[model samples]
Target: MDAGLKLRGIVAGYGQGDILRGLDLDVPAGQITCLIGPNGSGKSTVLRVISGLLAPRAGQVRLAGRNVTGWSPWAMLDGGVAHVPQERSLFPAMSVWDNVLMGAYINADRDAVARRATDIAQRFPLVARRRRDLAGSLSGGEQKTVEIARSMMLDPPVLCFDEPSIGLEPRARRTIFGILAELRRDGRTVLLVEQNARSGLAVADNGAVLDAGIVRLAAPASQLLDSPDVGRLYLGAS
Candidate 1:
């Protein structure tokens, strides 16, 4: 669960303008760290930087105390950084079992992938019940769970999730967050980017408030939840 992925003075954006301007933050090792912000606050950019999906114009990304600012996607995975993107990352045409197996393509051991699948099936009820079903046939929440289960196929130490609660009913969202809470309890480092501040922070040990591509505030989840400013600006609880 120890991750040393660091971002210092990172400047990144697509095409026209910069989304993250000199942003700096660290995903706590062996803890659940949630990133919250309004739309286009560079929340997703942070995940991309950690997963090596985007190269910073400046600054560094260190893992386990090693500089890996601009490593490729495969390099990041090899270094214990697994990123679950916001989009539907699973293969709709493939069976649930096959999708999970894809998580370990870099690993050469056939038995290892098989062993991981068994564990995944046990950890997630959806995978166990629908192992032979087409991944695309599942509901939104089920797909998210499968995505998470697939991520575990590698047993990554530091896993980053981008809006894992994107599209789902209230009930489904609760289930997904429940799974994440359990993961944190197991001493895994989880970096979650979620727009649902109230629920996201509820499961997080620490919460970082990102604004305009910068860290505006960082605090314990409980403390931040009670902050009047956070409630008004973030939770809209006024």
Candidate 2:
């Protein structure tokens, strides 16, 4: 399969020390790849590097066959990579519609933004249903739905999500996973960093186990789920 995104020899960290050590990864096009690991395993850091939140001290980041290493967040977005961070980025005082519209901030074409907004509203009914409501008024799941919808404003080819199902109810998590499946069906390459290893692998086409900032294991999601080594090492099974 062709890779939608590639990371080679990635070495990055914060402040003084490094967290990622010669990390390498490949996210295949038109599929979902989940990264799972113990806390401090550099899973989130990988997303940051891919989304341009952090620059790799070494290594390359390629998107759609183009080298995008060290690109700024805005540049990455413009280059077809959309990141939906773990934190809630919506404005509490803003209406849901306005919050969704913010996704097109980089776009100067008003007519295009309007057309995308309408398409997004249709795709994520919650955005249209709560169009007049304050973003803060919605539930956690609703907010996440809006976030994903907003991400589609640019119709990016690559989407990276960090802990998307974090702090959500079981039903909400399922909803989020369902959306992930839908995105895959839409032919978007998705890189997911999730703490819920089982659920993450369940929704993923491929799974990578990150340990000590490097890929320890990479395989089909089903294979990883059934692997005794994966169970003992990360899935907490005996």
Candidate 3:
């Protein structure tokens, strides 16, 4: 099967300075691909380029064999590529159920939206657990759970998550990884940028090491984790 998301020789940046140069990668379908790198290696930039938050100066981004480079964020979302950025993204005053439903805002069919919401709520019980509660009132971990549930409201084939486990306790981090594992079982392609290299690679099917704006290595997660050099340099010693 073709890789669900492909980036070839991509060059993207914020301004005059480029952060990602000649970056190439392929995220296989029905698997989780974790991206790990140092502080300035453009890990988050990769997600931004793929999700259309930033357009590349060159190269192409292909999703399911179709070139989608330079597409707008909204266009990318509509094209089955949903991005959950690094920051906290939720309406503080909205109810949990309402927040999840907000994800289907682009759809015009009320009945279809309601049906999808029902399915999502069933899949993520947290939505129902906090159905009537305000989003801001939930704990960080609970909020993250709601965010994941909201992202699924689109039912997209590919999901891009930027540090889904950031700013959480070990238990919460474990929950996020568990969610990623479940996503893979459901056949969704996941591109994840995680700072906790050890735990991230533990749940990932594949791992890519980014350095200085380029991919230095790409291999099976277990192989990368077992590599002494990789562990010493990036994985923080085995």
Clash numbers, per candidate = 0, 0, 0
- The digit string of per-residue lDDT tens for model 2 on 133-156 reads 999999999999999998999999
Whole-model lDDT values for every prediction = 0.89, 0.94, 0.92
Instruction: Give the per-residue lDDT digits (tens) of candidate 3, residues 152-233.
Output: 9889989999998989998988888898899999999999999999898999999999999999999999999999999998
Q: Candidate 2: minimum summed lDDT over ten consecutive residues — where? A: 1-10
Query: What is every candidate's alpha-carbon RMSD to the true fold?
Result: 1.2, 1.2, 1.1
* TM-score to native of every candidate shown: 0.96, 0.98, 0.98
Off by over 4 Å in 3: 1-3
TM-score of candidate 2 versus the correct structure, residues matched by position: 0.98
Candidate 3 accuracy as TM-score: 0.98
- For model 1, the local distance difference test gives 0.89
